[model samples]
Target: MPANNPPDQPPTPGQEPDRTIAYRQHNDQPYPQGYPQQGAYQQQGQPGYPQQGAGGYQQDGYQQQNYGQQVQPGYQQQGYGQQQNYGQQAYGQQAGYQAGHQQPGYPQQNYGQQPSWQQGSDFLGTGQPTAPPAKKGRKGWLFAVIAALVVALVGGGGAFAVNLLSGGGTQPHDVLPGDALGYVRLDLDPAANQKLALFSIAQKFTVTKSSFTGDDPRKALFDLLKKDGAGLDKVDYAADIEPWLGQRVGLAVLSPAKTGGEPGFVLAVQVTDETKAKAGIDKLMDGDKYGIAFRDDYALLTANQDQADQAVKAAPLSQNTNFSDDLNALGETGVLSFWVDAGRVASFAPELAAQNSEALAQIKNVRVAGALRFDGDYVELAGVTRGAQNLDMGQPEASKIGALPASTAAAVSFSGLGDIIGKQWAQILKSADQSGAGVQQFATQAEQTYGLKLPDDLTTLLGKNLTLALDSNGLDGDQPKFGARITTDPAKAQEVVGKIEKFLAASGTAAPQLAKVPGDGTFVLASSQEYAAELAKDGGLGDDESFKLAIPDADNATFAAYVDLDKLEKFYLQNLQGEDKANAQVLRAVGISGTQSGPDASFSLRLLFN
Candidate 1:
């Protein structure tokens, strides 16, 4: 036996501490001096803590048991019923205190259940209990919103990557002759992302979307071809063309066999199935006018069998060094591309050769290439002319049109006009009049009638930089405000103005007003004096947001142009109605810019969208 007679004191040697006494002490309630007697403890199912009885421990709403008896069905026992046992009973469980099962009228809870005092119970003073605060509702909508954002970001990023990296398909140069004089290719089947973009952009307007009834752009084009005089009325697209037709088609103008013979052409069409393509061509063409021959993945169509055979036998355009180099300089080849061998073309055409022999001889090695590309917000047509040195246009200089007013509706600026006119006047006149006598007579007549030097006065008037601008404010009235500002010597410009005034007076026509812009070495010729003064003011057009968006590289452009479609829409679209007017409104502006570098020159024309 162990000694434990004291109240609220530690147990004696070898004696177990009573959990009932510990629980009561934890709640700041006094423990009995000795073992509790039967019926002396609190009544069963009371709100306060459990107490030890003489026969067994009991709590409110719990069954009584003798010390040596087994636990009742409504209660669980770990130590009290059998001898010398002392472990905690599971709380908030059904019947015998097992996990995940609840007792009668008791809320279900995990093993780490809090004591009654901390579980919203008034057992410390009022002897009553309350339910735990209701749990908060789950925030499912927040998670859903997060998931949607994640998907959008991932999907958008993937699409952007595909648009930049995807290659549409085989190009036309893959099959054309290496030494062809010129080539034009149309790519109906582009990359997946490009096709999707084209479809989406087209669908934005009511007019364009009407033709694109389905997702297949190629089918729509074939349907259109069948309706027009495309000569495909007898053929069925689903059964005849779609069976073997590929995505790309190219037309090449071959050089003449000798200098005087006429140039021939070869049409190369991409084909997936050669047998079907051959059969389709037989049905579509007459033997006397057209011929077909297959090489690699393309079917070559020509005027005759011999030309078709020869085109296939020749080296492909992909292998031509000059053609490849020029195309590579042009960057991405888009839905449409064209290449011209200037030297070969000039050599083949007798009329062009006779008219400008000197110019043609100098451009014997030059080539010109261009492409058209589409984007989500804009469409761009870009071109490049290689070997520009052979036909020297003039040194490129940046245009100074950015000083025009922000209200400018349209403007075109050019540099090096004087140099081109001064150096090429004689050659130009010779080309226009091979006999040379007619041009001489015209010059003499002009000089005699106007009393001014011919080319000298013209070159001085044009100067280095010339810009023509139309202001939006002028469009409100019958006579629109417009002017041309030219960079030149003020005194010389005034002299030219005087000569023009005299000529206008002699002809009995009204003379236009011309004056120098204050502080700047430029002259403005306008419809009226007030408009000329407005043109002289610093308007900061270059710094305007719309102008910058339209002409991104205006600072480096030798030649540049801008037109505000929004400002001009009222004049051009006033008569349009319904879908046509709405579709036409999609265009916001157009910008053109060009640059020249030694033997290479490039230009870009872009149409911006709303």
Candidate 2:
């Protein structure tokens, strides 16, 4: 909190942020100021660094920040290259965050790196820092088991599949805070949803907001699940937590235990299934020109249909065929299947087979039970023997939205049951809104509220998503900033597409190039990625060989402003250093340029090149 210094501090002992770059940069991308020199975000006990490791919060005025302890917005796990094997805790547990890298060991057992990494962790796990359980002795006929997928389906009866595409069971969508790649947990018992399940649910439930926002505000998105408005009205807490004033789908899991236990099947699912709730498959207002938004999640399953079908066929069920087409389909009428745990039904449940689905069951045992986020537009139905209460009904939980007329609620659910997860997710976001911190303050407050110590690493992921959402929402831009442009560029467009691959690899936000080209046209990035109009204007445009080829319309800047070295020097000498707040001034005007012609057409594009 020193007045002279910036918020981020230098690296500390053992807490140094990884400064080594494994690969060489072909181009010279300027590092943010004080970047390698180390800013305020260092770990504790590092060489030449100060001993500051509390909350990095200052009391009065002059205190060095403990970068080690400073909760940042995008803290991710660091990985050292591939390790020969799963070593003792020593090599695994480093003091501070390291950039996720592959270790040299683990030739036999695969180790997962954290979420941001793109390469193989050798193991299927991301570098999430989990202590995987030890493998038992190899069992006989393992290959035989692997070879029995299709036949297994015939034997087991449930047409099931495990999809590696759609990012391994995760529906294609903006990567949200909890969207880190992970394993599917299969469990059984009385159905009551939980957070993990709700997250899975959100991944599946897709909605068409007149205008959507966020990495994916699906946390409390299940409020749209209403059969007759009864489900949404079940819990009075939806409106308080959800966003956009939507309805709660009444998605909940009533499991057997009150504490740590495996998540059972989705106990109650009351999603609003509009759009016929199935793959449009050559059927659409646009004539199934690819599935619609609600159907997008299901459509992603196409990438791994073969593998998924094989997996599904291996699951136990009565009769199954849809397995071939809808590799993710798991439902009745002699058709059953198994699916990778991407938020559909949890492991198999054997008891509630007859209930098919609970209808108007009293909320007797409901404690607002935990929630799960379902991803994609797919159905999972397994035929286990049934008892009095049926557990696995994909009814969307009701809470993200509120007060829907029964019919309206059902309409919403049937049409956008997939999107219900979106509504449900909107609610979880409220937990961040408390005390104005919203998610930014979660690291400090979450311990008491959620009862678990969610580290800053995870909080940063959430905060970044929230920040992007808020920025896009224009609550900050309702009036609109005249300086920002809303046009596109071809070369920049290409950059927009490439950035996703880069960002996902490092979880680092890169400026969008397409937004920089000053013009009047729609730039299309990959179908999935979006562009930030403002940042694009700031990136500056380019007219290279590729640019002239793709950009249908291109014109020289009606007004141009190259990097003004003299003006920058004068401004810095005259106003910055002379004033105590020079730090802030330097941050605003450092190494950036802009050009303007029409009131809104011109932009800052030179920075990308020079």
Candidate 3:
């Protein structure tokens, strides 16, 4: 490390340090200064330049700098139509540090032919290089990009709608995180949301001015109604109930039950003052009203009468520690959240329930929760899933999928692979037997068709844990590269490989190459020998910072996955057309993890954006 250089340590969370944008000015016995000091830079007040904020870019007072003998001539008009030129120096030319030194690649300046460029105002010394100006239309392009993001985020009115449904309150006072099978929390109050940098910046472009004027959202609603010729002028939401509006809101996905041929679910919200809330509701219902019920601070607002009734009858999250813990696993709190009760949902949703009864039965006992928060370059979403007693997450074996390489485009690891496959396979055979699709004769038919001895049972051929990963480097090639790592019993490993090879041969496909890595009987199956060799290398995601940040406690998780958002963006840009490619660039990375404790399991996903 050079003495004059700053520390190279990467930033810790919430600790972004200053990044040197310009070379430091030279001082003492010596060489000409490279650039001006902080103080001088602050005085520039350059337009379009970002001002210093609490966390970044503080400007100090200016200090004089020096320029040595390599000084070049100024200005040449390349004409406005071309990339803007800032005089003869080509805008980016600068003298080397040593006396009479000139940086390479720059055309030697001819003093005799030098054109006059603006002087004195240039804080950078005469010979010092100037920062290149932004390209034409760059600012407009950036604004458009940001506007698109804002519109997409605001689209669906879903942000507000979710908050409204879940009781958007500052505290989990009325309904605990566990009150519903799943819930989403969002900061819907315009004032509160604006505090967030994303919202704050977006608001600059958004129309903050309401039609009716003033700060009340009710007034804004009325004004909007009037614009549609609803004649809402007589309504006075402010006088009726604006005082009870809460800053934060939540939306909950309650346990499911069958209702009216549709999967039943309760959507609930929180009310600050029941009396005032009802009055406000009554006012809104003046034209057409839906049933509204209240329990404590929560308000049940759904068109489905039975679902609404069930919401009022069900146990609130306040009483369930499992549900609460699942929510807490996502985050103690967040701007917005979402949840799903796999078991409960499977019971009522006919489509889901119709899956192999065995598979559906296994899935029914799980509960999932997710949350959101604002963090560097990403709008993160965290999720959690819990499982039931009958469900197996391959506990004894657990998952030794280890870490994926940092560059992995996508990865998924799960335990209970054997158990799940075995169960599903059994169910398939049973259904086939009953449907006359094959049953007892299926195994023989499969063997004859594929010309391989098809095992009647699959559990014996696979392991408890499995990991599937893909790298970006592969997708661009003739065949997309992939890695499938499985943890099998050492005794059965050879037989398993043999079976797979035979199966592939029979199917008229190339056999996947494989390599054993150092872990609990773990081996890699890759699309090619090169990929297999690469998989044998170290640096599996185990120690990657991004992986750790996204999915902690991997060993305990029943399932985990990671997606390199940066790579995905690149892939999308290369393969996808239309606006989607542009929109895809916004994400940076995504990670998902799930852990089960007894009958309940929690799952979470973290999404990072650029």
lDDT of 3 by residue, 328-417 (tens): 455423445555666766666665556467667767667776655443334455556666556544443444444556567778887776
Error of 2 at 554 (Å): 13
Stretches of candidate 3 exceeding 4 Å from the true structure: 1-245, 248-280, 287-317, 320-330, 338-367, 396-407, 423-428, 431-442, 447-457, 472-480, 489-494, 497-520, 555-558, 568-570, 574-586
Q: Write the per-residue lDDT of candidate 1 for residues 149-178, one digit (tens) a residue.
A: 222211222122222223333466777888
Task: Name the best candidate (by TM-score).
Answer: 1
Query: Model 2 Cα displacement at 224 (Å)?
Result: 25
Report the error of model 2 at residue 69, Å: 34
* lDDT tens readout by residue for model 2, 391-481: 2322322111111111110100011222323433433345346336565354445445433333322322221111111111222333321
lDDT of each: 0.61, 0.23, 0.48
Q: Model 2, residue 23: what's the lDDT?
A: 14
Q: Distance (Å) between predicted and true CA of 405, model 3?
A: 4.1
Model 1 whole-model lDDT (C-alpha atoms): 0.61
Once model 1 is optimally superposed onto the true structure by TM-score, how far is the C-alpha of residue 107 displaced, in angstroms? 37
Candidate 2 overall lDDT versus native: 0.23
Residue 516 of model 1, lDDT score: 46
Question: Which regions in candidate 1 have their CA more than 4 angstroms from the true location?
Answer: 1-166, 215-234, 286-291, 304-306, 435-439, 446-450, 514-518, 527-534
